[model samples]
Target chain A: MIERIESFRRRRPRLLEERVTLAHGAGGKASAALVDAVFVEAFRNPLLEPLCDGAVIDLPGGERLVISTDSFVVQPRTFPGGSIGQLAVHGTANDLAVSGAVPQWISAAFVLEEGFPIAELKQIAADMAAAAAETGVQIVTGDTKVVPKGAADGVFVTTTGVGVIPAGRDLSARSVRPGDKVLLSGSMGDHGMAVMLARGDLAIEADIRSDTASVSPLVESLLAAAPSTRWLRDATRGGVGTVCNELAQACGLGVLLDEEKLPVRPMVAGACELLGIDPLYVANEGKIVAVVAAEETEAAIAALRSHPLGADAAEVGEILEEPAQTVVVRTGFGGTRIVDMLVGDPLPRIC
Target chain B: MIERIESFRRRRPRLLEERVTLAHGAGGKASAALVDAVFVEAFRNPLLEPLCDGAVIDLPGGERLVISTDSFVVQPRTFPGGSIGQLAVHGTANDLAVSGAVPQWISAAFVLEEGFPIAELKQIAADMAAAAAETGVQIVTGDTKVVPKGAADGVFVTTTGVGVIPAGRDLSARSVRPGDKVLLSGSMGDHGMAVMLARGDLAIEADIRSDTASVSPLVESLLAAAPSTRWLRDATRGGVGTVCNELAQACGLGVLLDEEKLPVRPMVAGACELLGIDPLYVANEGKIVAVVAAEETEAAIAALRSHPLGADAAEVGEILEEPAQTVVVRTGFGGTRIVDMLVGDPLPRIC
Candidate 1:
């Protein structure tokens, strides 16, 4: 690793222009490039080679451990239906869950600004505790650091989770096949729309609530029903469209999403329309995109729908052999258009 | 856990003032109270009951896992001899190492402010990679988030580490006995003073460099020489004084430190005198406090001195049976003074 890092340092290829932009955090091309150039290049390792949502480690005891992390810098700390605390817990738990790991322990670290409200902090803690209990995970350890007022936004929470993946359950984007069926575990754009509305940045208002709930239970049901699931990922920062693109690229396959079949709440859809944002590119906290064998699609959907968080689950897409490494959305008007990752963040700090 | 949280909420004792003050994060009385009221009261679990530097879990295969997390919000991203990235890695690794765990995997989550320099980010990542390699730990998985320029100070790195504790090697503050010897790995105040100089906050300037190096090797040496080592901790955010307080409270014992035995660099001592700050309260990223049986004190110090990071290691304090849960410092002028925890953060975001 030292030799690899030294080799890169010797080249010193000007990786970025000068300053980091919002696009760098948009979970798009820019984000990928930043990660590859700065992090992956420096800390190259087999566990991180897959570039999956989480890293899988094999313990000496023949147990597989999956670890994932996320930092929540959502605006308005408290949003409709949930707060940053809930998002922090659910985000990492979902990441591990989607990786075929049974979420177990989580560590939360908070960077708080001085003069923040103690009452609000307590409320956030309560939200985190409730989310952990509901997901059957324990918040085992934590750290808190306070910065002077103005040095940081109200509060930012980073949660890192560890879970155990049962033997024989190997979930990865590389397992995706050309004939795989794509499953959407619930509606799109709910989390982003809800946060945007709560921020009141736009004059438009809607009765939208974030689908901020843990997807672990839903994942358990899906895995039990469709043991041949190829890949799984939560539609987070860059949303379902971005996830499809990542999956397609990872497997060198094409994805075709039927626009008419995409699950989206009416309120979220209306807000996306008003904001001129594609629902497919808006984040959803309590949603997932699963790729399963074509033969198991029905069972997967059935299992997902059996869970409250996935009641709106649907088979929205399928993998195609042609147009490799791309995502095309079939329009309601019988037309098709390529769906690319967002170039820049439409709603900064939405989650 | 749910019932406990509900019971606390029902009381509504107004545990804290409306707003969070710097004291709440000083790792002192206020910080303890805040954690007890907000986090401990909510996420009550067996693993978290000890409230030690890290949480220990028993893996199914008879292996014990220690997990710890810390967020680096240092004022200056780059300080003399080290950077926030190095601190992030060493900080978490030391937490696990002191817990008698062989540091293994670490996950880092970064929160960057928009418009931050990409070159600086690259340097930080490189620093982290070097630190990880030096510490024999792998950077497995990570996440990155960006906030608008003013929303965050610059960059805050949160690292969560996981390690495996060898069989029958239990290290905890609760294990400290009345006849224990407290050994200091090296000098104090170097890290805090170096960061202060980097920030250019005060008119006084000192030629001090942070002792920001991994302490795992030193810990290995000590453990080998003195298998009876009872407790270990890195003197970090709140410094050795704060750690002493916590250790005393956790074990229901008193700690006595000889002022003459305390090691401090000439530059740091001069700076501390100018600023009217006690060196004991200054943070040390690369130093550690090991509590070993009185009979093993000589061997522990000898072993520590064999390592580069612990060249200046010395037995500076001892555990006492009387004055349980208190810390006293013997003055060079033939007097003793209570070394109470700081009421407020003298150096906020010092990491």
Candidate 2:
């Protein structure tokens, strides 16, 4: 390996601006060059220097902070609709958003399962940089670790984000009340279904795609309009059922869902039915479930509908006082059954 | 999968506490039970209950904070001197120590390559819990991700540590001065050589053991005595050569090492000679390189020698201004040659 690097140093090519290579993931000269030329060059800032393993940021205003870390193991490395790179940025931003914090900094750690193509890694890095810029967050620090071929499956990313919540903003599952209305931001189960369809037995491609996105700004606006928004959860792993169940556990209340009023795309619904999977147990990367005071339901829904990613927003259910700790879904056949928390992750590795 | 869990739930015996099976890493019922009955039972703390991806702790006093992350992927999983679990703890804690930080909370994430023996996993977890207790640092939160068989090599551990340093106690590479003395906390390259010997490559066994340990207390003592300590770096990946070269670059100074004065165990020396690798480039998990003011050189050495992990501490060399940014090793024959950083890692996956 040292001999190879020595040979490269002797050549010292002039085409400094090109796609990345495996050497970039190596913690050596080539890797340093890659960082200097691409990530740091594009996202020029004092914070990203001679980068530290992690960044030390002082809150602009002294307040309790929000911190989140997520790891993305999305297979295929790159897929239709979105790549793992974009998913990392959006996933982290959404974490901060739901916590009612305006995210300020992010740390990206890439674990490249060896044999992953360099061009693809570079593309992923570029996507991450662009996504960070778009979301108004700084990719302040990063660490790259490369495992030998076969030790890792493909490319896995672990991103850590820090955000600051404005003082006086109270958002928690504990704050949710029995009469609060549940508002879902956009179509459900698109993200997980898209990835599954992209990977497996789907003979025909569908219009449905992963609705992965950053919702910090959208969340801020909604919370601003409806300060009484009791609770918010990004419908991620285990989909709506998981978040609702956690909320139920948190608030000590039950939820009753009107299945006829729930929004599900035809393609997603059909795919779930064919796969013998319940859409409720699937995951969604961008959709969020907001439990708000009934008086502010309209304003919350309006805020969600205004965002492009939330156009299909709808009021699906409301918190209930009776049937403690159980979620009953009212079906179109005048029958009702429990909408329990997902037993386990059915659509595994959706993130 | 859900049925499997339900069956386990219905017929569950009193917490399968004795033998471990593959299900422990399966992210299912067994895994959750393992965490509950064992890890939680042993390391129970309120901060760990939330079970976020990692722990978020606010430093007690208002001072600059230090944070670091490391991954441990060792072959044979456990060896003569250390296990992957111990390495994970020492690797991350040392990162904090060398950075002039008083290590605090740590988050340990495990990625188990499938088919890892359950007994081995339990032992590894026990090793980690014990190590954390010894160091007085809490493993506040954790995550476990399981990959199918052949997806990972045994189990890989990634730990992130957060520490805090007093505001004025700055330790920087550039702080090294012309007359500064360099100190080693312990014997060099034992970790690498021990692992190499354990790899079953030699006609004769080398009685080497890994110097894997936490260097925080040692570093603190050294700093306390030599309050004007210029810099500190763990002699780990890429070893002494890489660290010296890095210091030269950052400090804009040259470092000259008297090869005769440098310390290396005879067993390790024989192994390095046999493998045609330089001991200077071999890794050390517990050892540290401290650059201290010449006036406090004796005090620093005494400080180091007091720590159990630093009984073999020695002053190896001194910082010099001639030919700034170069590392020269003085051979016994009165000849000198540049000791450059290993361009790429000499032993791939050595860590």
Candidate 3:
């Protein structure tokens, strides 16, 4: 019997058992089956199945787009406030959103270390699906690769997202100029402190939780309200300090932040003090820093302060043409210290 | 001192102490310093120096493109034939190429396991730079995070590549049809087998080296010769078997391969016999499986044969509409066996 492409798919590979391991994540066999059995089955579409390297997405109303990729390797796999799965979704989506893109689709690639818990894998998949639903982006495509037990941490996730930005709404750090106002969506240090608490760093016992969640909606609101918004950045890897330093450098302007105005929860501050960590340099998963033109700053603040995700929004800083390309923190005592990107890994405690 | 965006240089973070540790890769302070000292310093440019969340690249020729992301977490980070560094470049580039795109620029993100040798990282970085340069792509942007020792293996690398395919190049498994010819470029299983050999699994070692090289040039040649080529798949992950099966399913056709025509190296085949692994399922980093129309099969083969990378290329199979979506292998003895994607991890090896 001379068979062709279609004939063989009739005898598609079956999931060997109900347990998950690193190999299943290896972007190979197990990964394919996992996607077939879970993600593809959940999100059915022609674009999802060709399993093309990445989703060749078509933007609604027609416009060229924005794309981003991120990998999540959170230790403890399951965290106090969220799982690695949830973090993967929000973390990547936010990356796209802050870039001023309407987050649409994401490609999730998982690297499962050998012998990982199967239930954990399914749970992660479920979380991924749910997060996708919330973000209005589907897990359009993925790859799995399995390495030997010693090759990886329990699991690492790499996601690439594609989003469309409507024309005429420019969002880049270079757009910031003198008199632009910096707006923070919510409290800082909660996510970092929560991780320390999860690690049981000390008896100080922080009740603060990771603020990880989808921010596309918040970003959408801001972009709509502040059409003149110059830049948007989420405080993630290198936290606020790193992002601000980047912004200043990108715009050739100085970013002056009033330290007392930053929204830091009491418990997070206590944890940071006890741990000797600078909250400014530590990672934050759920917050964003937006630089809006001075004219729209008030309306933008009002719009953000009314949203659930940004009710604690604060006007923490301003862009100045003087002292260009530096982040200067105005101390509570009226003095200023140069705030720079944490050049090295700031908190060696977490991945 | 104040500096213009053009004049501004990223500052080095204050040191905790001498000597890098696992904690440095933890997405904290140390990770930042490592990025500033090494990667940022090495690949400084206007587009990269800002260290934004993701690079806003100018897609050449204004074509809608394909973007793929991959993270390399192979154990032994460095192996006899290659290191995770080169693997990162190859893996991401191949992902884009197989999707029928001209692999272009890449962004690399490293999660360095703390206390790992700096020299090792330097080597990986050099390999990455060399690989990108050779492939006509630039490592336009990158990020580094360090995690303390116990929390990591040696190191893990994540690379995201974006490539542009000419409009109307409808290449996909779904396009394979009856009367199509399936071709294999060079030998199979060298890459995976090399991994096994590197691990010292067998007493009878084959001189078989890892077929770890870029397949984009080969793909370019095949497309140029047979512009109507149906599908081009790198037989990675689940190897040739899975690729055939994928084509079969996508085209709603069956594919039958003549076993004798497959270019399996004798030594690699012998080693597989001793190890009980199917060469069909072992990963092939460098080889590609292409299915093309009946009319230009010889021209496709001729084009492949001309390239050193595709010297051993051969037409191994034919596609038929009957018995849709199945893969059948005609044995040397005139019998046939179904070749399907593996149900689980084949060897649980890293990419």
lDDT of each: 0.84, 0.68, 0.67
Candidate 2 Cα errors over 4 Å, as ranges: A1-63, B1-63
Give the worst 10-residue stretch by lDDT in candidate 2 chain A.
A1-10
Clash counts per candidate, in order, are 0, 0, 65
Query: What would the per-residue lDDT of candidate 2 be over residues A1-351, giving only the tens digit for each residue?
Result: 111122223333232434333223222234334323322222223332312211222332355455556667676556668888988898877877887878766656555565555456656777776677778875544444556777777767776676667778767766778889998887778888889888866685787788888888779888988899987878876678656766665566888888877888999999888878877767787888899999999999998888887788899999999777667888999999987656434555577
Q: For residues B113-216, could you state the per-residue lDDT of candidate 2 as single tens digits?
A: 54555456656777876677667665543444555567667667767676666567877765689989888887778988887777785675867888888888
Residues A120-233, model 3: lDDT tens digits: 665777777667777886554444554555656677777767677666766765567898899999998777667657766468755677888888888888888889998887
Worst 10-residue lDDT window, candidate 2 chain B: B1-10
Indicate which candidate wins on DockQ.
Answer: 1
Clashing pairs in 2: none
- Over the stretch A1-351, how does candidate 1's per-residue lDDT look in tens digits? 121122223323244547888877877666776776888777876644543434788889998898788899998888888999899899999988988999999998888899888888988999999899888898988888888999999999999999999889988766788889999998999898899889876897788899998999999999999999998989988899988887776677899999999988888888888789999999889999999999999999999999988888999999999798789999999999999866668878877
DockQ of candidate model 1: 0.54
DockQ of the candidate models in sequence: 0.54, 0.04, 0.06
Candidate maximizing TM-score: 1
Query: Least accurate stretch of 10 residues (summed lDDT) in model 1 chain A?
Result: A1-10
**Cand 1, B chain, TM:** 0.93
User: How many backbone clashes are present in model 3?
Assistant: 65
